[model samples]
Target: MLLYHTIALAAGYLLDLLIGDPRWLYHPVCLIGNLITLLEKGIRKIFPKTEKGELFGGFLEVILVCLISLGVPCAVLSTLYRYMPLAGLVLETFWCYQLLATKSLKDESMKVYDRLKNGTIEEARYAVSMIVGRDTSELTEEGVTKAAVETVAENSSDGVIAPMLYMALGGAPLMFLYKGINTMDSMLGYKNDRYLYFGRCAAKLDDLANYIPARISGWLMVAAAFLTGMDGKNAVKIYKRDRRNHASPNSAQTEAAVAGALRVQLAGNAYYFGKLYEKPTIGDKLREVEPEDIRRANRLLYGASVLSVLLCLGGRLLVQFLV
Candidate 1:
C-alpha cells in the first residue's frame, strides 16, 4: 500500500509541476466549494438564527463536508483497488495532482508581476485582487507587488506543502479531507458579523489542522531559501522571530521565511471588505519590494516543494523498510 501510494504521489507531483492546473479541466475543489455553498443554504434554513444555533450549524457543516470528502474518495479508491489496482493508482495520482497548487500559484502571481512590470498599475491591482482576499481597487503598484509576493509566500504552505503533507500520510483520501477543511475555512472563516459565530468551529478546526504543517513548511522554506540562493540565515531568523505575527497561527510561518529570505517587508496593513486592517509588517525592509520579487518568491516555492516531496518519499521508504 505504501509503495503504491509513494509512486502515485511522485507521479502527481511531476504532473502538477509540469502542467499546473488546466483551465479546461474541472477541478475537485469546485465540487467541494459547491457542496459548502449548498450546505450553508440548507443549514441556515434548518438551524435557528441565534448565535449558538449558527455555531452548531457551522460545526455540522464541517462534519458533513469532511465526511463526504473523506468517505467518497475512500470508497471509490478502495473499490477500484479491489477490482483493479492499476485503475486505482491512476485515479489516486490524479487526485494528488489536483490537490497541489505549485505552478498555479506561480502563474497567478506572475500575472500581477507582468502587469506591474509593464507599468499598468490598475491592471496589476486587478490581477492581484483575484488571488488575495483583501480589497485591491485603490492599491498602488507597490501594494500590488507586495500582495502578490505575500500570497505566494503564505500559500506555499496552505496551497502546496500542507496538502502534500496530508497526501503523503494517508494518500489522496486524507488530502481530500484536508481540502474540505481548508475550503470551509476559506469560505466561512471570516471574522465579520456574518461569520464570526457561525464560522468559529471551521476557523478553529483549520488552525488545528494546519498547526504542525505550517511550522514544518516554515523550516523547509528556510532550507529552500539556502538551496535557491536566497538568505537562508536571515530566513531562519525571521521565521523564528516573526512567524507568530499574524492573526492566524499558521499564516505567518511561511510569510516570515519568505520575507526574511527576500529581505523585504510584508504583511503590513491592508483593506479587507472595504475596511482597513492594521497589520504588523514581517521581516526587515532592507530594500524596496519590486516586481522581480514575485519571480524570486516562486523560486523559493518550487525549491521548498521539491524538498518536501523528497522528505515525504524518504519517510515512506523508511516506513516500508521497517515493516
Candidate 2:
C-alpha cells in the first residue's frame, strides 16, 4: 500500500510536471461540474417555493451531493482494487492527485506573476480571476499579486495538504472521497439564496474534513517557511493573528503564516458575485504585494508539501513497527 501510494504521488508529480493544469480543457473535475448542473436542475423540485422549503433544500442538497459524489466515485475506484491491485492503486492515486491542486495552484499563480511583471494589470487580473473567487476587473497589480499569493498559500492547505492527510490515514479511496467532498463544496457550497439550502451538507462536510488537516497544514507551512529561509518570527505572528479569519478553519493557518512571513496584508475587501466582501486583515502593516512574494509563497508551499510527504512516510513506518 505504501509503495502504491508513493508510486501514485510520484506519478502525479511527474504528470503535473510534464503537463500543467488543463483547466481550459477536459479536466475530469469538470465532470463534477456537469454533475452539479444536473443536481441544480433537480434541486428545484425539492425547493419548491414553500415555507422552509428553501432551508430544507440546502441541507438535503449538500448531503446528497457529498454522498453521491464521494460515495459513488470511491465505490467505483475501490471495486477496481479487487482485480487490478497495483494498476488500480496507481490509477486511483493519479486521480486523487488530479483532484488536488498543488502544482496547478503554483503554476496558475505564476501566470499572474508573469503578467504583473510585464505591467499588464489587465492580464494579471484576468489570470488571477481564473483561480480565485474574487473580482479582479479593477484590482491593481499589487492586489493581483496579493490575491495570487493568498490563494496559493491557502490552497496549499486544500489542494495539497488535506488530500495528502487523507491518503496517509486511509489510502486512495478515502483520499479521493475527501477530494470529492471538497470539490462538491467548491462547486455548490455557497451561502446565497440559490445554494444556501442545497449546498449546506457539502459545505459542512468540507469543513469537517478540512478541520484537522488545515491546522496541520498551517503548522507545516510555518515550519516550511522557516525551512525556506523565511523569517520564523513573522510566520508565527501572522499565524496567530490572521489564521482565524479564513472562512475555513484550516485555510487560515497557512495563509496567515505566509502573509505574516512576507509582511503583507491580505484578505481585505473584495468583490464576489458583484458584491464586495470585506475579509478581516491578516499579517502586519504591509507593503504592496510583488510578484516576488508570489514566488516566496510558492517556495514555502512546495517545501510544506515535501515536508508532509516525509512526515507521512515516518508515521507509516512507525505504524508498521508497532504492528
Candidate 3:
C-alpha cells in the first residue's frame, strides 16, 4: 500500500504539472461547492438565525460535506481495487491529479501578468479579479501587479502544498476532504454580515487545518528562494518578522516569504466588498513590484511544491521502515 501510494503521488504531481485542470471536465471542487450551497440552505431553514444556530448549522454542513467527500471515493476505489487492481490504480491517479492545482495556479496568474505586460490595465484588472477576493476595479498598474503576486504567493500554500500534504497522508479521500473544507471557507467564510455568524465554524476549521501546512509552506518557500536564485536570507528574515502580520494566522506565512524572496513589499490597505481594509505591509520595499514578479512568485511556488513532494515521499518511506 505504501509503494502504491508513493507511485500515485508521483503520477498525480506529474499529471498536474503536464496538463493542469481541463476546462471541459466537471471538477470535483465544483461538486463540493454545490453540496455546500445545498446543505447550507437546508440547514439554515431548520436552524434559527441566531449566532449559535448558525454556528451549529455550519458545523453540520462541514460534517456532511466531509462525509460525501470521503465516502464516495473510498467506496469506488475500494471496490475497484478488489475487482481490478490496475484499474483502481489508474482511477486513483486521476483522482489525485484532479486534487492538485499547480499548473492551473500558474496559468491563471500568468494571464494577469500577460495583460499587465501588454499595457492593458483594464484587462489586467479583469484577469486578476478572477482569482483574488479583493476588488480590482480601481487599481493602478502597480496595485494590479501587487495583487497578482500576492495571490500566487498565498495560494502557493492553500492550493498546492496543503493538498499535496493531505493526499500524501490519506490519498484521495483526505485530500478531497481538505478541499471540501477549503471550498467552504472560500465560499462562506467572510467577515461580512452574511457569513460572519453562519460561516464561523468553517473559517475556524479551515484555519486549524491549514495551520501546520502554512508554516511548512513558508519554510519551503525560503528554501525555494535559494534554489531559484532569489533572496533566501531576506525570505527567512521577513518571514520571521512578518509572518503574523495578517488577520488570519496562516495567510501571511507564505506572503511574507514570497515578498522577501522578490525583495518587494506586499499586503497594504485594500478595498474588499467596497470597504477599505487597512492591511499591514509584509516585507521591505527594496524594489517596486512588477508584472514580472508574478512569474517569479510562480517559480517559487513550483519550487516549493517540488520540495513538498520529495518530503512527502521521504516521510512515507521513513514511516514504513519504522513500522
| Alpha-carbon deviation at 198 in model 3, angstroms | 1.2
Q: Please tell me which model should have the higher lDDT, number 2 or number 3.
A: 3
The candidate, 2 or 3, that scores higher on TM-score is 3
253 Cα displacement, candidate 2 (Å) = 1.7
Give the alpha carbon lDDT tens digit for every residue of 194-307 in model 1.
Answer: 899889999999999999999999999999999999999999999999999999999999999999999999998989888899999999999999889999999999999999
Query: Once model 1 is optimally superposed onto the true structure by TM-score, how far is the C-alpha of residue 171 displaced, in angstroms?
Result: 0.4
Q: How many clashing pairs per prediction, in order?
A: 0, 3, 0
lDDT of 1 at 316: 87
lDDT of 1: 0.94
Count of backbone collisions within predicted model 3: 0
Provide the RMSD of all predictions against the true structure, rounded to 1 decimal.
0.7, 2.4, 1.0
Question: lDDT for each of the candidates?
Answer: 0.94, 0.77, 0.92
Error of 1 at 221 (Å): 0.7
Candidate 3 residue spans exceeding 4 A from truth: none
Tell me the TM-score of each prediction against the true structure: 0.99, 0.90, 0.98
Best by lDDT: 1
